[model samples]
Target: MQTILSRVLKNSTFITSIISILLGILVGAIMMIMAGYDPILAYNALFASALLQPYDLGETIRTITPLILIGLAVALAFRTGLFNIGVEGQVIVGQLVAVIIGLKLGLPPVLHAVVAIIGGGLAGALWAAVPGLLKAIRGVHEVIVSIMMNFIALNLSNVLIRRWLAQGTDSTPEIPESASIQMDFLSQLFGGARVHVGIFIALVAAFIMYYLLWKTKLGYELRAVGYNPLASEYAGMSVKRNILLSMMISGSFAGIAGAAELLGTSGYQSIQATFTGIGFDGIAVALLGANTPIGVILASILFGVLTYGGGNMQFEAGVPFEVIRVVFAAIILFVAANISGPLVNLFSKRRRDKHRARHLD
Candidate 1:
């Protein structure tokens, strides 16, 4: 454990993230003081409510489950030099497909859940393939195509759910027991906080992503293409194929995130007036985690804590939940600025100067 902690501390990205988080907290405190609130009390209440109880901790984990998957989705794209902003759309489509399969399929328990989850992922991949095709074949930018696809996915999903599954209802049918990811023992342990098998699925997905990106030939090609399409093509790599594959893989993870949410938490797809903000939230997680698999998981946990604890902070300390959001925003902004790189450079320069001075003396 100590070795792991030491390595994490030594990682420049991780150190920078810590600095950003501390600065964010400091900003939050300033805001709270300006508004006549007690920052310490509010933060204490947040932590207490989020960690001091089994239920709270369980709820935080449950919230984290899908975020971890979504974070992985975005992080994978980041590593491969793709901004898969369409993950929102991919997740929506995945949710719709998972609900349809869960409601209609009649397989055995474990098998049914597996099928539904995979079905959702497949749906997301297909949905993402459109933008991928456009980008790969037509030389169109993915950001534009993916953003447009998000609107299409939202409205198209609404239409499909209403016409095919709902047929005059406001929501799709509840997921059958066969397709539910909920585990009785886990639920019991958490006092019915709705944690499920999705966490394990998310962790496994992270491991798969890590292994695929760092340990496989295909991973090398994908990353190589992302690093320099011209060089990769000169090396006989198929840039277009890698681009399409990367988007599809990213979308698959997002879709799995959607399926996990429905199967493990919500159990049904309601008519959405808006895209679930969770997809956009993944961008922050990816940034904060430095687009690494382990970073995504750790970042998801931090986000979950802040998100779940915000309400308690509001109630106990009379601070608005929006303040917590502000802190999150601040952290993301700082991370985006790449503050850690500059800080590291400054520290290195200072060390060099000190060494030169000592040698001269």
Candidate 2:
């Protein structure tokens, strides 16, 4: 038992992530005490509201649905050593295309939904492809391009929504029933919580991402390139192609998230002056999960629970929701700090040098 425990504790990444979470919670509790609130009562109310009731549970699952896909999008890019900040842009364009297809295309019920989902994925892929192409061909950094693409996608989407789709309105028409992904039986089971079939789609996507990254030839190439692009190129792999393909694949996952949102959650495209922040949250989720598919699911669940339950903390315990946000930011910060090997090494070096110089003197 001691040996087993030792081995388990030796996994630095796992230990770091767990410690970060605990420390974040500890900080939150301290803040609550300082603010004259009972931390235990607030936490209890949060979990109770999020998990103790069927309706809230269903909403939690619904929120987790898109997060799963978004996390996967960011995770895949990280696995391939590509920073896909364009996921937000991909999601925006994906929604725009999915809504348009859902409104304009007439088809059978199942087919209509399928087409909308596919359109969203393709749109995302196309949007992400531009940055990937530039990065591969011109040595441009993906982060810069994707960040700019986010603004472009946002403004373009707003224009399309106002001028073409809604006739000067800020939102588009609700999609037809044929394009809806809601499962009546599932919703009824969850006490009319508006959960949809997209959960299954998200699960399948997770499985596929796992299989593609760890079990197949293409997965091997992507991982290899991520490990060492120069070595991969020397071994006959096309670095440029892999770079582009990985970004496109990542974008497609983000696009599917957008499709799931429109078909099951929102049902219409609204002109947004601000980002939804789901794509950005995905970056945190991917990092928190250590860029693994299964990890992403767990991390997404953690985030989803907090998101759905924060309101209850406010209502039942008189704790402000901003406290929850601080806890979240702290978790990310600690996780980053723990994983920063250079920072740790630098401190260790300074300590050693100071001790050695004192001995010499």
Candidate 3:
């Protein structure tokens, strides 16, 4: 029975997540009907708007880009037993550096964009390194330090955007032509939505992250350290170094997330009325995707579709968009709590059985 339960659990992660999603949608529909909205109309409108229209679909993909990057960032860190809650801060710092480089440099368009992106990644790495160093060297709690750093980065970004980067108006100066990406091609293809090359970049990054985590020596050491730091240490691996490296790499991915948002989507540095909650959402994505690069990407796209569809749901049926967020939260909680462990175990057992059969043959 225990083995069967473990096998069931191993198969349940994806199935559980899917069930949670369906349950959430059903509940959302009930709520919408109770609120005097036509649930079917809202849901259909959402699906149509997110999928049927080219521009709408493109926008959905564009929204997915940053989510994929940040989701992977969170997953990478989580795999190594590090809770990096400072992705928000790392993203802000990266955006600042990208903006600065985009505005100041007089290089060619491609070169300017590349340099700015690299600069943003470096800035994020530096910011993440702080908490990493503290945790590794001083035995401080990374969760606390990362959370504090998030607050600092939030305040710092707001101040910098309003004071140093603002144009004659409140927002920062528009990025120069040389630094701007060519979204026109995507717009034309998608009927005027702002989809860009960033989506391709995200896909490439996902593959790169997969290779790094599954096929590389560093990845093995990182996972070992995460699973059992004492054992890793006994194996002659430097746990501190791996921790720092993981954090820095995680931050760099988040930096790319910010760059995708600022450079590819917004095209300028600006402060939001409230801190964007993408960092927190990344946690949900990571968990649902089972902390794998492929899973993260797919989960992020699922979220992107839901969000994009939610807007039309509101427009067509007058259902509040906040309800969509509620549904997403419920789904995430249920999937995280009841699914992953059993699913992984089942897969592991199946793989082991296969290996034994092959060897015997």
Candidate 4:
């Protein structure tokens, strides 16, 4: 068991994530003590609410579903050497398109849902394609273009929601039942929490991403370009084309996240005064997950637990929920500092030296 644990801890990414989380917890405890709160009681309430209660657990899962998708979006962009700060815009466009299609299309239940979801993803892909094209063709920095596009998408979504698609208010009408992703059995099983079949969708998406990134030729080209675009271009790869493709794929994940949130949970699309922080939060998710599909899923679940439980902590311990955000920020800071890299190297070197001594003996 010890050997197994040692092998697992030898993985740099895993070790880094664990260390970051531990440091985050320690810092959070210190902050709570400074704020005149009992850290142990606060954390107990948080865990009890988020994990031990059925309704809260379901809500945590609901939060995890979209986070998994958005995390994948950010991870994909990072792997392709692009900063996709426009996931918020992609999500907005996706939700708008899904709402429109769900309202207008009359079809069989399964077909309607599928079409609406796909349509939303396509809209997100198109929305992101603009920035991708500018970056690829005009040599404009993608980060700048994506940020500008975010504002455009937000304003456009607001206009469409209020004027064009609004039933009477700043939101579209509840989508047709056929287009919903709600699962009655799961809801009942979870004590009427809003958990839905979207969790399954998120899982499938993660599997697909894993397969695409590790098993496909196209993925190789994309990663190769990311590592060195000039070298890839010299090797006869289309660097520009790969950039566009990567952005579209990344945006599609964000679009699916929007679809899941609207069709699976909210049942209606509402205009937002500001961007939902999910897209931005996805950056942290991808960072902590080390840009891997499995890592993203695990990290998303952790985030979901923290987010859902933070409310309970606040209510029970009189601690501010913003402290959860502070914890998260601390974790990100530690990860960025590469605190675990040296530790990992030191352990590996010690292990190798021990093996060499054993062989000589």
Candidate 5:
């Protein structure tokens, strides 16, 4: 408990998030006023729409699906000091691969779903591996390479969806029933809701990631390398391999995110070239979660609420949906700029000095 409190106290990022959240609310209210809207009514309506209404609740969960998975991907790479910006590309590849497998070979329900999800993960791994390999062998910076790979994947997905896989319609073929994770079967249970089993799958993955990062030897090595690569190398750890492994795992996680969206939620075989912003949102989720699995889960839900609420704000208050983007941008900037090690050291030292004075009693 003491350690937890001390860590929280020392974390400038956490403090910054809190401050930014409050500031964002104030700024949003000002915008609401400028637009001749009542801020209080707008906020109340936003909460009601996002949480109280069934349709809004469903949309909230839908948005969260990719956020959780992609946030996990980013958090995983961060554990090994890798900034994997290729999650956007990895997600696209995963979506493509899952749809391909679902359409190509029709199998039993369980097997088909498994293959589609796994195939998506593999595609993500392959996409991420290119940058990983470059970083490992050629000493290239991963940030630049990963960003480039995102563009490549985006264009590739566009071409594949528009030309080859498209069914002469806006989207590709409908996924085989066997591979779909829609909750259509549970119509009697929830009044024909769109909520699928994919949410459970995402939660399970989060638990698995928590265990992998906290209770395993590989996790330790990954963290060691992340702390200091040169020191990790001197300690006889395979720094290069760990870097590659980190990126692959990160990419795989993001790939599964895409699969979750394609099979479990959207069910569309072909998505737009610029469909969702989950990749970018994942970065914010990672920071808010404090780079922990449990934190990520909580952060994802909070973001879901915001998104849902924002939609309500738009519908009832006449506020623009784009306002949410501005709020998020402000919060991210504050969190990114304020968090650092020196802040932790300063707080720790002050606490120790206090402890020494108390001991004299």
Candidate 6:
């Protein structure tokens, strides 16, 4: 049992993630106490609200639908040694494109939905390609370009929506039923919650990403370039092409997240006063998950639970909902600290020294 425990603890990344979560919870409890709230009661309410009811569970799953895709997007980019700060822009562009296609295209129900979703993915890929191309060709920093593109995408989406699709209000017309991703059976199963078939789509996407990154030659090239661009280039790989490909792929995942939101839930694109923070939250998700596909899925679930349950905490315990965000922020900070490796190493060294002394005796 001791050997098994030590072996499990030796996984520094897992240990770090777990420790970060526990520490974040501790910090949250301390804050709750300082604020004159019972931390245990607040947390109990949160968990009860989120998991003890079918409706809230469905909503939690729905919320994580986009988060899963966005987390995967950021993780993919990180694995390729790129930071895709423009997932927000890509999502905006993709949502606009999806709405346009759903409104304009007339086809069979399944075909129409499929085409609109694909259009959204393509738009995101194209939008991200610009930054990738600039980074590859002109040596422009991707972070700067991506951030600027986010602003541009926001403005452009508003302009296009108003000019072409906006109804009496700031949002586009409701998408046709044919293009909707909602399934009546799924909703019924979840006690009439608005959760849709998009959750399954997200699962499939995660599997696809895992396969693409781990099983394919193209993925190998991309990973190689990410590991060492100079070495990859010396080995006759096209670093520029791989960079562009990585951004496009990453953008596609974010774009699909937008499509899922529109077709599965919102059914229309609204002009936003501010960028939706899903893309930004995705950064934390990726970090917490250690940039792996499976890790992203699990991290998305944790975020989903916290976000969906926060309202209940406020309602039932009078705790501020923003406390959830604070906990999430603390988790991100600890994960970024990367302190688990040294702790694990120290423990392993002590164990080795003790074993040596026993042998000498």
Question: Backbone collision count in every prediction?
Answer: 0, 0, 6, 0, 0, 0
Candidate 4, residue 50: lDDT: 95
**Tens-place lDDT digits, model 5, residues 1-361:** 6568677856535565666577777777887788788988887887787777666677677778788899999998887899998898899999999988988887999889989999999999989999999999999999999999988888888788888888777678878889887766543344445667777777887887888878899988888988999999999999999999889999998999998789986676654657467787898888877788877887788788788788778778888877777777766666666644455678678788889999997
The lDDT of each candidate is: 0.90, 0.89, 0.84, 0.90, 0.82, 0.90
TM-score of each: 0.95, 0.92, 0.90, 0.93, 0.88, 0.96
RMSD of 4: 2.6
Pairs clashing in candidate 1?
none
Per-residue C-alpha lDDT of model 4 across residues 1-361, encoded as one tens digit per residue: 5456556666658888889999998999999999899999999998889989888999999999989999999999999899999998998888888888899888789888889889888988998899899999998998999999899999998898899888788788999999988988999999999999889999999998889988999999989989999999999999999999999999999998888788889988887888888889999999999999999999999999999999889899888999999999999999888788777567778778888999999
1-361 per-residue lDDT for model 1 (tens digits) = 5445444544658887888999998999999999999999999999899988888888999989989999999998888888888999999999988988898889999999999999999988888888888888998988899999999999988888888888589888888899999999998898778999999999999999999999999999989988999999999999899999998999999999999889999899888888878999999999999999999999999999999999889889999999988999999998888777765566666667887999999
Tens-digit per-residue lDDT, 60-156, candidate 3: 9888888898898899999998998889888888888888888878899788888877888888888889899998999898889988988888888
After superposition, the stretches of candidate 6 with alpha carbons farther than 4 Å from their true spots are: 1-7
Largest TM-score belongs to which candidate? 6
Better of 1 and 2 by TM-score: 1
Ranking by TM-score: 6, 1, 4, 2, 3, 5
Displacement of residue 30 (Cα, Å) in model 6 is 0.9
Tell me the lDDT of candidate 2.
Answer: 0.89
Name the 10 consecutive residues with the lowest summed lDDT in model 6.
3-12
Point out where model 2 deviates above 4 Å: 1-3, 339-361
Worst 10 residues of 2 by lDDT: 2-11
Q: Write the per-residue lDDT of candidate 6 for residues 159-223, one digit (tens) a residue.
A: 98888898767999999999998888888888888898778888988998899889999999989
